[model samples]
Target: MVGHTLELRGSPFLQEIIREVPGGERIVHCLQCGTCGGSCPNGADMEYTPRTILAMITANQRDKVLKANTMWFCVSCYSCVSRCPQKIPITDIMYGLKRISIREKAYQETDAPALAKTFTDLLDKYGRSFELGLASRYYLFNRPLAMLKMGPMGLSMFTRGRMSLTPTRIRNVDQLQAIIRKARELGGVS
Candidate 1:
Protein backbone atom coordinates (compact mmCIF):
# COMPACT_ATOMS: atom_id res chain seq x y z
CA MET A 1 0.00 0.00 0.00
CA VAL A 2 1.20 3.51 -0.85
CA GLY A 3 0.71 6.61 1.25
CA HIS A 4 0.43 10.27 0.37
CA THR A 5 3.62 11.75 -1.02
CA LEU A 6 4.96 15.15 -0.08
CA GLU A 7 7.63 15.72 -2.68
CA LEU A 8 7.03 19.39 -3.42
CA ARG A 9 10.60 20.24 -2.56
CA GLY A 10 12.22 21.18 -5.89
CA SER A 11 9.56 21.44 -8.55
CA PRO A 12 9.38 24.92 -10.00
CA PHE A 13 6.15 23.97 -11.73
CA LEU A 14 4.53 23.12 -8.42
CA GLN A 15 5.70 26.39 -6.94
CA GLU A 16 4.33 28.28 -9.92
CA ILE A 17 0.99 26.52 -9.45
CA ILE A 18 0.96 27.47 -5.79
CA ARG A 19 1.50 31.08 -6.72
CA GLU A 20 -0.87 31.10 -9.66
CA VAL A 21 -3.93 29.57 -8.03
CA PRO A 22 -5.72 31.05 -5.02
CA GLY A 23 -5.74 27.88 -2.91
CA GLY A 24 -3.22 25.90 -4.93
CA GLU A 25 -0.83 25.48 -1.98
CA ARG A 26 -3.15 22.78 -0.71
CA ILE A 27 -2.18 20.70 -3.71
CA VAL A 28 0.82 19.38 -1.80
CA HIS A 29 -1.62 17.62 0.51
CA CYS A 30 -3.14 15.65 -2.33
CA LEU A 31 -3.20 11.92 -1.53
CA GLN A 32 -3.29 10.86 -5.18
CA CYS A 33 -6.46 9.05 -4.15
CA GLY A 34 -7.97 9.52 -7.60
CA THR A 35 -11.02 11.06 -5.97
CA CYS A 36 -10.64 14.32 -7.80
CA GLY A 37 -10.34 12.64 -11.17
CA GLY A 38 -13.23 10.31 -10.54
CA SER A 39 -15.43 13.18 -9.43
CA CYS A 40 -14.77 15.19 -12.57
CA PRO A 41 -17.65 15.31 -15.06
CA ASN A 42 -15.30 15.57 -18.01
CA GLY A 43 -12.46 13.43 -16.81
CA ALA A 44 -12.97 10.91 -19.58
CA ASP A 45 -12.60 13.65 -22.17
CA MET A 46 -9.31 14.91 -20.77
CA GLU A 47 -5.98 13.68 -22.03
CA TYR A 48 -4.84 13.42 -18.43
CA THR A 49 -6.87 13.15 -15.25
CA PRO A 50 -6.50 15.66 -12.43
CA ARG A 51 -4.70 13.00 -10.42
CA THR A 52 -2.20 12.37 -13.22
CA ILE A 53 -1.73 16.08 -13.73
CA LEU A 54 -0.74 16.48 -10.09
CA ALA A 55 1.72 13.62 -10.39
CA MET A 56 3.14 15.22 -13.52
CA ILE A 57 3.54 18.45 -11.62
CA THR A 58 5.45 16.68 -8.86
CA ALA A 59 7.60 15.05 -11.52
CA ASN A 60 8.19 18.45 -13.11
CA GLN A 61 6.78 17.42 -16.45
CA ARG A 62 6.09 21.05 -17.26
CA ASP A 63 5.75 20.75 -21.01
CA LYS A 64 3.47 17.72 -20.99
CA VAL A 65 1.26 19.06 -18.20
CA LEU A 66 0.85 22.44 -19.84
CA LYS A 67 0.25 21.02 -23.29
CA ALA A 68 -2.32 18.47 -22.19
CA ASN A 69 -6.04 18.99 -22.76
CA THR A 70 -6.78 18.22 -19.14
CA MET A 71 -6.99 21.83 -18.03
CA TRP A 72 -9.04 22.92 -21.01
CA PHE A 73 -11.58 20.18 -20.46
CA CYS A 74 -12.31 21.39 -16.93
CA VAL A 75 -15.72 23.01 -16.74
CA SER A 76 -15.13 24.66 -13.34
CA CYS A 77 -18.00 22.66 -11.89
CA TYR A 78 -15.96 22.27 -8.68
CA SER A 79 -17.00 18.63 -8.34
CA CYS A 80 -13.39 17.60 -7.83
CA VAL A 81 -12.78 20.35 -5.33
CA SER A 82 -15.85 19.38 -3.38
CA ARG A 83 -14.92 15.70 -3.28
CA CYS A 84 -11.16 15.78 -2.64
CA PRO A 85 -10.26 14.35 0.75
CA GLN A 86 -7.31 16.69 1.01
CA LYS A 87 -9.65 19.61 0.29
CA ILE A 88 -7.39 20.67 -2.54
CA PRO A 89 -8.82 23.33 -4.81
CA ILE A 90 -8.58 21.28 -8.00
CA THR A 91 -10.85 23.52 -10.04
CA ASP A 92 -8.82 26.61 -9.21
CA ILE A 93 -5.67 24.73 -10.13
CA MET A 94 -7.22 23.97 -13.48
CA TYR A 95 -7.86 27.68 -13.96
CA GLY A 96 -4.26 28.43 -13.02
CA LEU A 97 -3.04 25.84 -15.47
CA LYS A 98 -5.19 27.44 -18.16
CA ARG A 99 -3.69 30.86 -17.47
CA ILE A 100 -0.21 29.41 -17.60
CA SER A 101 -0.95 27.52 -20.80
CA ILE A 102 -2.27 30.65 -22.48
CA ARG A 103 0.68 32.68 -21.27
CA GLU A 104 3.17 30.07 -22.48
CA LYS A 105 1.20 29.10 -25.62
CA ALA A 106 1.66 25.53 -24.53
CA TYR A 107 -1.64 24.36 -26.00
CA GLN A 108 -1.92 22.61 -29.31
CA GLU A 109 -4.55 23.11 -32.02
CA THR A 110 -7.65 23.36 -29.83
CA ASP A 111 -10.59 25.73 -30.18
CA ALA A 112 -11.07 25.94 -26.41
CA PRO A 113 -8.40 28.60 -25.92
CA ALA A 114 -9.70 30.75 -28.74
CA LEU A 115 -13.27 30.44 -27.47
CA ALA A 116 -12.18 31.28 -23.96
CA LYS A 117 -10.38 34.39 -25.17
CA THR A 118 -13.41 35.57 -27.08
CA PHE A 119 -15.71 35.00 -24.11
CA THR A 120 -13.40 36.85 -21.75
CA ASP A 121 -13.02 39.75 -24.17
CA LEU A 122 -16.77 40.09 -24.43
CA LEU A 123 -17.18 39.78 -20.67
CA ASP A 124 -14.55 42.46 -20.09
CA LYS A 125 -16.13 44.81 -22.60
CA TYR A 126 -19.79 44.44 -21.64
CA GLY A 127 -19.46 43.39 -18.01
CA ARG A 128 -21.36 40.27 -19.14
CA SER A 129 -21.29 37.80 -21.97
CA PHE A 130 -22.80 38.77 -25.31
CA GLU A 131 -23.84 35.38 -26.58
CA LEU A 132 -24.62 36.48 -30.10
CA GLY A 133 -21.41 38.39 -30.43
CA LEU A 134 -19.44 35.56 -28.90
CA ALA A 135 -20.88 32.94 -31.24
CA SER A 136 -20.57 35.21 -34.28
CA ARG A 137 -16.98 36.15 -33.61
CA TYR A 138 -15.91 32.66 -32.65
CA TYR A 139 -17.50 30.89 -35.57
CA LEU A 140 -16.59 33.64 -38.03
CA PHE A 141 -12.93 33.33 -37.19
CA ASN A 142 -12.72 29.68 -36.15
CA ARG A 143 -15.03 27.99 -38.62
CA PRO A 144 -16.21 30.33 -41.32
CA LEU A 145 -18.49 27.83 -42.98
CA ALA A 146 -20.06 26.92 -39.68
CA MET A 147 -21.30 30.48 -39.29
CA LEU A 148 -23.43 30.05 -42.40
CA LYS A 149 -25.05 27.00 -40.91
CA MET A 150 -25.76 28.85 -37.65
CA GLY A 151 -27.45 31.80 -39.35
CA PRO A 152 -30.93 30.31 -39.27
CA MET A 153 -30.65 29.34 -35.64
CA GLY A 154 -29.27 32.74 -34.76
CA LEU A 155 -32.12 34.45 -36.58
CA SER A 156 -34.70 32.24 -34.90
CA MET A 157 -33.27 33.03 -31.47
CA PHE A 158 -33.23 36.75 -32.20
CA THR A 159 -36.81 36.64 -33.44
CA ARG A 160 -37.93 34.79 -30.32
CA GLY A 161 -36.17 37.36 -28.07
CA ARG A 162 -33.91 34.62 -26.79
CA MET A 163 -30.91 36.50 -28.19
CA SER A 164 -30.05 40.12 -28.74
CA LEU A 165 -28.43 41.60 -31.78
CA THR A 166 -26.39 44.15 -29.85
CA PRO A 167 -24.64 44.14 -26.55
CA THR A 168 -26.03 45.94 -23.53
CA ARG A 169 -23.34 47.28 -21.30
CA ILE A 170 -23.71 47.35 -17.59
CA ARG A 171 -24.34 50.70 -15.88
CA ASN A 172 -20.97 50.58 -14.13
CA VAL A 173 -18.81 49.08 -16.84
CA ASP A 174 -15.88 51.22 -15.73
CA GLN A 175 -15.97 49.62 -12.31
CA LEU A 176 -16.01 46.17 -13.86
CA GLN A 177 -13.12 47.06 -16.15
CA ALA A 178 -11.18 48.41 -13.20
CA ILE A 179 -11.71 45.17 -11.33
CA ILE A 180 -10.62 43.13 -14.34
CA ARG A 181 -7.57 45.35 -14.80
CA LYS A 182 -6.57 44.93 -11.17
CA ALA A 183 -7.01 41.15 -11.44
CA ARG A 184 -4.79 41.05 -14.52
CA GLU A 185 -2.20 43.17 -12.78
CA LEU A 186 -2.16 40.96 -9.71
CA GLY A 187 -2.09 37.82 -11.86
CA GLY A 188 0.89 39.24 -13.81
CA VAL A 189 -1.08 38.54 -16.94
CA SER A 190 -1.02 40.76 -19.96
Candidate 2:
Protein backbone atom coordinates (compact mmCIF):
# COMPACT_ATOMS: atom_id res chain seq x y z
CA MET A 1 0.00 0.00 0.00
CA VAL A 2 1.19 3.51 -0.81
CA GLY A 3 1.40 6.02 2.04
CA HIS A 4 -0.27 9.42 1.73
CA THR A 5 1.68 12.53 2.69
CA LEU A 6 0.72 14.05 6.01
CA GLU A 7 -0.22 17.75 6.07
CA LEU A 8 0.64 19.46 9.32
CA ARG A 9 -1.59 22.04 11.01
CA GLY A 10 -0.64 25.73 11.50
CA SER A 11 2.32 24.98 9.33
CA PRO A 12 2.14 27.14 6.23
CA PHE A 13 1.48 25.18 3.08
CA LEU A 14 3.26 27.86 1.10
CA GLN A 15 2.42 26.26 -2.22
CA GLU A 16 -1.25 25.91 -1.31
CA ILE A 17 -1.31 29.44 0.04
CA ILE A 18 0.14 30.88 -3.14
CA ARG A 19 -2.24 28.89 -5.29
CA GLU A 20 -5.29 30.13 -3.38
CA VAL A 21 -5.41 33.27 -5.47
CA PRO A 22 -5.35 33.29 -9.25
CA GLY A 23 -2.25 35.42 -9.69
CA GLY A 24 -0.49 35.19 -6.34
CA GLU A 25 2.52 33.20 -7.56
CA ARG A 26 3.49 36.11 -9.77
CA ILE A 27 4.34 38.08 -6.61
CA VAL A 28 7.38 35.85 -6.24
CA HIS A 29 8.87 37.12 -9.46
CA CYS A 30 9.26 40.75 -8.47
CA LEU A 31 12.82 42.06 -8.92
CA GLN A 32 12.22 45.12 -6.71
CA CYS A 33 12.77 46.98 -9.94
CA GLY A 34 10.68 49.91 -8.63
CA THR A 35 8.31 49.94 -11.57
CA CYS A 36 5.27 49.61 -9.30
CA GLY A 37 6.48 52.37 -6.99
CA GLY A 38 7.14 54.71 -9.86
CA SER A 39 3.70 54.15 -11.36
CA CYS A 40 1.67 54.62 -8.18
CA PRO A 41 -0.20 57.92 -7.79
CA ASN A 42 0.30 57.82 -4.04
CA GLY A 43 3.88 56.61 -4.02
CA ALA A 44 5.12 59.62 -2.06
CA ASP A 45 2.62 58.82 0.68
CA MET A 46 3.80 55.25 1.35
CA GLU A 47 6.84 54.32 3.39
CA TYR A 48 6.79 50.93 1.74
CA THR A 49 5.69 50.54 -1.85
CA PRO A 50 3.85 47.63 -3.47
CA ARG A 51 7.14 46.12 -4.50
CA THR A 52 8.36 46.38 -0.93
CA ILE A 53 5.20 44.67 0.39
CA LEU A 54 5.82 41.71 -1.92
CA ALA A 55 9.40 41.54 -0.74
CA MET A 56 8.32 41.67 2.91
CA ILE A 57 5.75 38.90 2.45
CA THR A 58 8.35 36.66 0.81
CA ALA A 59 10.66 37.33 3.77
CA ASN A 60 7.87 36.28 6.20
CA GLN A 61 7.54 39.83 7.52
CA ARG A 62 3.78 39.91 6.83
CA ASP A 63 2.94 41.20 10.30
CA LYS A 64 5.17 44.21 9.74
CA VAL A 65 3.40 45.08 6.53
CA LEU A 66 -0.01 44.53 8.13
CA LYS A 67 0.75 47.24 10.69
CA ALA A 68 1.64 49.89 8.15
CA ASN A 69 -0.59 52.49 6.38
CA THR A 70 0.57 51.28 3.00
CA MET A 71 -2.28 48.78 2.49
CA TRP A 72 -4.98 51.27 3.45
CA PHE A 73 -3.63 53.80 1.00
CA CYS A 74 -3.74 51.53 -2.03
CA VAL A 75 -6.52 52.74 -4.35
CA SER A 76 -6.88 49.28 -5.98
CA CYS A 77 -5.60 50.69 -9.21
CA TYR A 78 -3.94 48.05 -11.36
CA SER A 79 -1.22 50.38 -12.57
CA CYS A 80 1.45 48.50 -10.65
CA VAL A 81 0.61 45.16 -12.21
CA SER A 82 0.04 46.67 -15.60
CA ARG A 83 3.52 48.07 -15.71
CA CYS A 84 5.37 45.28 -13.93
CA PRO A 85 8.22 43.89 -15.99
CA GLN A 86 8.00 40.61 -14.10
CA LYS A 87 4.25 40.47 -14.80
CA ILE A 88 3.69 40.26 -11.08
CA PRO A 89 0.14 40.71 -9.81
CA ILE A 90 0.88 43.57 -7.44
CA THR A 91 -2.74 44.70 -7.16
CA ASP A 92 -3.92 41.27 -5.95
CA ILE A 93 -1.14 41.19 -3.39
CA MET A 94 -2.28 44.58 -2.15
CA TYR A 95 -5.81 43.16 -1.71
CA GLY A 96 -4.63 39.96 0.01
CA LEU A 97 -2.39 41.96 2.30
CA LYS A 98 -5.25 44.29 3.22
CA ARG A 99 -7.47 41.30 4.01
CA ILE A 100 -4.81 39.95 6.36
CA SER A 101 -4.38 43.32 8.00
CA ILE A 102 -8.11 43.74 8.61
CA ARG A 103 -8.54 40.18 9.81
CA GLU A 104 -5.78 40.66 12.36
CA LYS A 105 -7.22 44.01 13.53
CA ALA A 106 -3.64 45.26 13.51
CA TYR A 107 -4.54 48.50 11.77
CA GLN A 108 -7.80 50.38 11.88
CA GLU A 109 -8.85 53.28 9.72
CA THR A 110 -11.71 55.19 11.33
CA ASP A 111 -13.35 55.88 7.98
CA ALA A 112 -13.49 52.18 7.23
CA PRO A 113 -15.65 50.99 10.13
CA ALA A 114 -18.87 51.67 8.26
CA LEU A 115 -17.50 50.15 5.09
CA ALA A 116 -16.28 47.05 6.84
CA LYS A 117 -19.57 46.44 8.59
CA THR A 118 -21.59 46.97 5.45
CA PHE A 119 -19.43 44.63 3.39
CA THR A 120 -19.49 41.85 5.97
CA ASP A 121 -23.20 42.24 6.57
CA LEU A 122 -23.88 42.18 2.86
CA LEU A 123 -21.94 39.00 2.36
CA ASP A 124 -23.51 37.36 5.38
CA LYS A 125 -27.14 38.34 4.76
CA TYR A 126 -27.69 38.38 1.01
CA GLY A 127 -24.57 36.56 -0.10
CA ARG A 128 -23.96 39.65 -2.23
CA SER A 129 -24.25 43.39 -2.27
CA PHE A 130 -27.36 45.43 -2.82
CA GLU A 131 -26.09 48.89 -3.63
CA LEU A 132 -28.87 50.75 -1.85
CA GLY A 133 -28.74 48.41 1.09
CA LEU A 134 -25.01 48.90 1.33
CA ALA A 135 -25.34 52.68 1.26
CA SER A 136 -28.05 52.71 3.88
CA ARG A 137 -26.18 50.21 6.03
CA TYR A 138 -23.01 52.25 5.84
CA TYR A 139 -24.80 55.46 6.71
CA LEU A 140 -26.64 53.79 9.58
CA PHE A 141 -23.56 51.93 10.80
CA ASN A 142 -21.72 55.22 10.90
CA ARG A 143 -24.75 56.63 12.73
CA PRO A 144 -27.56 59.00 11.77
CA LEU A 145 -25.67 62.09 12.84
CA ALA A 146 -22.81 61.36 10.55
CA MET A 147 -25.03 61.14 7.47
CA LEU A 148 -27.17 64.09 8.60
CA LYS A 149 -24.12 66.35 8.42
CA MET A 150 -23.87 65.71 4.68
CA GLY A 151 -27.39 67.12 4.18
CA PRO A 152 -29.52 66.71 1.04
CA MET A 153 -26.46 66.45 -1.17
CA GLY A 154 -25.60 63.04 0.22
CA LEU A 155 -29.10 61.66 -0.27
CA SER A 156 -29.65 62.99 -3.78
CA MET A 157 -27.88 60.48 -6.00
CA PHE A 158 -29.00 57.39 -4.11
CA THR A 159 -32.64 58.50 -4.25
CA ARG A 160 -32.35 59.19 -7.96
CA GLY A 161 -31.51 55.55 -8.78
CA ARG A 162 -27.92 56.32 -9.66
CA MET A 163 -27.23 53.48 -7.28
CA SER A 164 -29.36 50.42 -7.93
CA LEU A 165 -31.63 49.05 -5.21
CA THR A 166 -31.19 45.45 -6.35
CA PRO A 167 -29.04 42.77 -4.74
CA THR A 168 -26.87 40.74 -7.10
CA ARG A 169 -25.18 37.46 -6.28
CA ILE A 170 -22.51 35.81 -8.33
CA ARG A 171 -23.71 32.52 -9.84
CA ASN A 172 -22.38 29.39 -8.15
CA VAL A 173 -22.53 30.91 -4.70
CA ASP A 174 -21.44 27.62 -3.12
CA GLN A 175 -18.25 27.49 -5.11
CA LEU A 176 -17.58 31.10 -4.26
CA GLN A 177 -18.08 30.30 -0.61
CA ALA A 178 -15.70 27.36 -0.84
CA ILE A 179 -13.04 29.56 -2.36
CA ILE A 180 -13.71 32.13 0.32
CA ARG A 181 -13.51 29.42 2.99
CA LYS A 182 -10.04 28.49 1.80
CA ALA A 183 -9.00 32.13 2.07
CA ARG A 184 -10.43 32.46 5.57
CA GLU A 185 -8.69 29.28 6.63
CA LEU A 186 -5.40 30.77 5.55
CA GLY A 187 -6.10 33.89 7.65
CA GLY A 188 -7.28 35.93 4.68
CA VAL A 189 -10.65 37.73 4.49
CA SER A 190 -13.70 36.25 2.68
Candidate 3:
Protein backbone atom coordinates (compact mmCIF):
# COMPACT_ATOMS: atom_id res chain seq x y z
CA MET A 1 0.00 0.00 0.00
CA VAL A 2 1.19 3.51 -0.78
CA GLY A 3 1.86 5.68 2.22
CA HIS A 4 -0.67 8.45 2.83
CA THR A 5 1.50 11.32 4.02
CA LEU A 6 -1.12 14.00 3.59
CA GLU A 7 -2.09 15.97 6.66
CA LEU A 8 -5.07 14.67 8.57
CA ARG A 9 -8.19 16.77 8.99
CA GLY A 10 -11.95 16.55 8.76
CA SER A 11 -13.03 15.87 5.15
CA PRO A 12 -16.04 17.71 3.90
CA PHE A 13 -15.00 16.40 0.49
CA LEU A 14 -15.61 12.82 1.60
CA GLN A 15 -18.88 13.83 3.19
CA GLU A 16 -20.03 15.36 -0.05
CA ILE A 17 -19.11 12.21 -1.96
CA ILE A 18 -20.93 10.05 0.52
CA ARG A 19 -24.04 12.14 0.10
CA GLU A 20 -23.85 11.93 -3.69
CA VAL A 21 -23.35 8.21 -4.09
CA PRO A 22 -26.11 5.70 -3.50
CA GLY A 23 -25.34 3.54 -0.43
CA GLY A 24 -22.18 5.60 0.09
CA GLU A 25 -22.85 6.23 3.76
CA ARG A 26 -21.93 2.59 4.31
CA ILE A 27 -18.33 3.57 3.57
CA VAL A 28 -17.95 4.59 7.19
CA HIS A 29 -18.43 0.96 8.17
CA CYS A 30 -15.47 -0.43 6.21
CA LEU A 31 -13.61 -3.07 8.15
CA GLN A 32 -10.18 -2.91 6.47
CA CYS A 33 -10.64 -6.63 5.82
CA GLY A 34 -8.84 -6.52 2.44
CA THR A 35 -11.63 -8.48 0.76
CA CYS A 36 -12.38 -5.66 -1.62
CA GLY A 37 -8.74 -5.39 -2.60
CA GLY A 38 -8.28 -9.11 -2.99
CA SER A 39 -11.42 -9.42 -5.04
CA CYS A 40 -10.54 -6.63 -7.45
CA PRO A 41 -9.58 -7.92 -10.90
CA ASN A 42 -7.33 -4.94 -11.61
CA GLY A 43 -6.12 -4.37 -8.09
CA ALA A 44 -2.49 -4.74 -9.12
CA ASP A 45 -2.75 -1.69 -11.35
CA MET A 46 -4.27 0.59 -8.74
CA GLU A 47 -2.23 3.11 -6.79
CA TYR A 48 -4.45 2.40 -3.81
CA THR A 49 -6.64 -0.64 -3.33
CA PRO A 50 -10.31 -0.29 -2.54
CA ARG A 51 -9.73 -0.96 1.14
CA THR A 52 -6.90 1.57 1.27
CA ILE A 53 -8.99 4.19 -0.49
CA LEU A 54 -11.67 3.79 2.14
CA ALA A 55 -9.08 4.24 4.87
CA MET A 56 -7.70 7.29 3.10
CA ILE A 57 -11.19 8.71 2.86
CA THR A 58 -11.62 8.35 6.60
CA ALA A 59 -8.14 9.74 7.24
CA ASN A 60 -8.90 12.85 5.21
CA GLN A 61 -6.27 12.26 2.55
CA ARG A 62 -8.33 14.23 0.09
CA ASP A 63 -5.64 15.14 -2.43
CA LYS A 64 -4.05 11.71 -2.40
CA VAL A 65 -7.38 9.97 -2.68
CA LEU A 66 -8.59 12.18 -5.49
CA LYS A 67 -5.37 11.91 -7.49
CA ALA A 68 -4.91 8.17 -7.12
CA ASN A 69 -5.47 5.92 -10.13
CA THR A 70 -7.37 3.42 -8.00
CA MET A 71 -10.69 4.81 -9.10
CA TRP A 72 -9.77 4.57 -12.77
CA PHE A 73 -8.68 0.95 -12.43
CA CYS A 74 -12.10 -0.14 -11.27
CA VAL A 75 -13.82 -2.08 -14.10
CA SER A 76 -17.21 -1.96 -12.33
CA CYS A 77 -17.15 -5.76 -12.18
CA TYR A 78 -18.82 -5.61 -8.74
CA SER A 79 -16.46 -8.31 -7.46
CA CYS A 80 -15.37 -6.16 -4.56
CA VAL A 81 -18.89 -5.11 -3.75
CA SER A 82 -20.04 -8.73 -3.78
CA ARG A 83 -17.17 -9.81 -1.58
CA CYS A 84 -17.37 -6.98 0.94
CA PRO A 85 -18.46 -8.23 4.35
CA GLN A 86 -19.58 -4.77 5.33
CA LYS A 87 -21.44 -4.28 2.03
CA ILE A 88 -19.79 -0.88 1.59
CA PRO A 89 -20.80 -0.44 -2.06
CA ILE A 90 -17.14 -0.20 -3.03
CA THR A 91 -17.92 0.19 -6.72
CA ASP A 92 -20.19 3.15 -6.08
CA ILE A 93 -17.47 4.72 -3.98
CA MET A 94 -15.07 4.22 -6.88
CA TYR A 95 -17.55 5.91 -9.18
CA GLY A 96 -17.89 8.79 -6.73
CA LEU A 97 -14.11 9.16 -6.64
CA LYS A 98 -14.02 9.23 -10.44
CA ARG A 99 -16.69 11.97 -10.57
CA ILE A 100 -14.84 13.96 -7.95
CA SER A 101 -11.54 13.53 -9.76
CA ILE A 102 -13.04 14.77 -12.99
CA ARG A 103 -14.77 17.73 -11.31
CA GLU A 104 -11.59 18.73 -9.43
CA LYS A 105 -9.23 17.99 -12.34
CA ALA A 106 -7.18 15.93 -9.93
CA TYR A 107 -6.68 12.65 -11.82
CA GLN A 108 -3.43 11.55 -13.40
CA GLU A 109 -2.89 11.72 -17.12
CA THR A 110 -4.54 8.55 -18.47
CA ASP A 111 -6.82 7.26 -21.23
CA ALA A 112 -9.54 6.52 -18.68
CA PRO A 113 -11.12 9.96 -18.86
CA ALA A 114 -11.01 9.95 -22.64
CA LEU A 115 -12.45 6.44 -22.89
CA ALA A 116 -15.23 7.31 -20.47
CA LYS A 117 -16.10 10.41 -22.48
CA THR A 118 -16.07 8.41 -25.69
CA PHE A 119 -18.37 5.76 -24.24
CA THR A 120 -20.82 8.30 -22.86
CA ASP A 121 -20.83 10.28 -26.09
CA LEU A 122 -21.51 7.18 -28.15
CA LEU A 123 -24.23 6.02 -25.80
CA ASP A 124 -25.91 9.43 -25.72
CA LYS A 125 -25.79 9.83 -29.47
CA TYR A 126 -26.74 6.30 -30.52
CA GLY A 127 -28.49 4.92 -27.46
CA ARG A 128 -26.01 2.03 -27.47
CA SER A 129 -22.35 1.29 -27.92
CA PHE A 130 -20.81 1.17 -31.38
CA GLU A 131 -17.57 -0.71 -30.86
CA LEU A 132 -15.99 0.10 -34.20
CA GLY A 133 -16.92 3.73 -33.91
CA LEU A 134 -15.74 3.84 -30.33
CA ALA A 135 -12.41 2.22 -31.20
CA SER A 136 -11.90 4.51 -34.14
CA ARG A 137 -12.63 7.66 -32.16
CA TYR A 138 -10.68 6.63 -29.08
CA TYR A 139 -7.62 5.54 -31.01
CA LEU A 140 -7.68 8.57 -33.32
CA PHE A 141 -6.78 10.81 -30.40
CA ASN A 142 -5.27 8.59 -27.73
CA ARG A 143 -3.09 6.01 -29.49
CA PRO A 144 -2.94 5.89 -33.24
CA LEU A 145 -0.20 3.27 -33.04
CA ALA A 146 -2.38 1.01 -30.88
CA MET A 147 -4.95 1.10 -33.64
CA LEU A 148 -2.44 -0.53 -35.96
CA LYS A 149 -1.72 -3.17 -33.39
CA MET A 150 -5.42 -3.86 -32.86
CA GLY A 151 -6.11 -4.28 -36.59
CA PRO A 152 -5.32 -7.98 -36.68
CA MET A 153 -7.39 -8.74 -33.59
CA GLY A 154 -10.25 -6.61 -34.87
CA LEU A 155 -10.16 -8.40 -38.19
CA SER A 156 -10.18 -11.73 -36.45
CA MET A 157 -13.21 -10.76 -34.43
CA PHE A 158 -14.96 -9.48 -37.52
CA THR A 159 -14.23 -12.67 -39.45
CA ARG A 160 -15.45 -14.72 -36.54
CA GLY A 161 -18.68 -12.74 -36.46
CA ARG A 162 -17.89 -11.62 -32.96
CA MET A 163 -17.79 -7.94 -33.88
CA SER A 164 -20.59 -5.99 -35.49
CA LEU A 165 -20.05 -3.55 -38.33
CA THR A 166 -23.11 -1.52 -37.52
CA PRO A 167 -24.43 -0.04 -34.32
CA THR A 168 -27.79 -1.27 -33.08
CA ARG A 169 -29.95 1.53 -31.83
CA ILE A 170 -32.23 0.81 -28.93
CA ARG A 171 -35.97 1.06 -29.39
CA ASN A 172 -37.40 4.32 -28.02
CA VAL A 173 -34.06 6.09 -27.76
CA ASP A 174 -35.91 9.29 -26.92
CA GLN A 175 -37.24 7.63 -23.79
CA LEU A 176 -33.73 6.52 -22.91
CA GLN A 177 -32.52 10.08 -23.30
CA ALA A 178 -35.33 11.34 -21.13
CA ILE A 179 -34.50 8.87 -18.38
CA ILE A 180 -30.82 9.81 -18.56
CA ARG A 181 -31.72 13.49 -18.48
CA LYS A 182 -33.91 12.99 -15.42
CA ALA A 183 -31.18 10.97 -13.71
CA ARG A 184 -28.67 13.72 -14.34
CA GLU A 185 -31.14 16.31 -13.04
CA LEU A 186 -31.58 14.22 -9.93
CA GLY A 187 -27.80 14.14 -9.29
CA GLY A 188 -27.15 10.69 -10.76
CA VAL A 189 -23.88 9.81 -12.50
CA SER A 190 -23.18 12.32 -15.24
User: What's the TM-score of each model vs. the native?
Assistant: 0.88, 0.67, 0.85
lDDT of 2 by residue, 102-134 (tens): 666777554564586678768855578676777
Question: How many clashes show up in model 1?
Answer: 0
lDDT of 1 by residue, 94-174 (tens): 888988899899988778888999999999999889998999899989989988898899889889999987898999999
Error of 2 at 175 (Å): 11
Query: What is the lDDT, from 0 to 100, of the residue 152 in candidate 2?
Result: 76
Per-candidate local distance difference test: 0.86, 0.68, 0.85
Q: Which stretches of candidate 3 lie over 4 Å from their true place?
A: 1-10
Q: Of 2 and 3, which scores higher on lDDT?
A: 3
What CA RMSD would you report for each candidate? 3.2, 7.2, 5.1
Query: Candidate 2 — which residues are off by over 4 angstroms?
Result: 1-20, 113-117, 143-146, 158-190
lDDT of 1: 0.86
lDDT of 3 by residue, 48-120 (tens): 8999998888777889989999999898999998889988988988888898898878988778888989999
Higher-ranked by TM-score: 2 or 3: 3
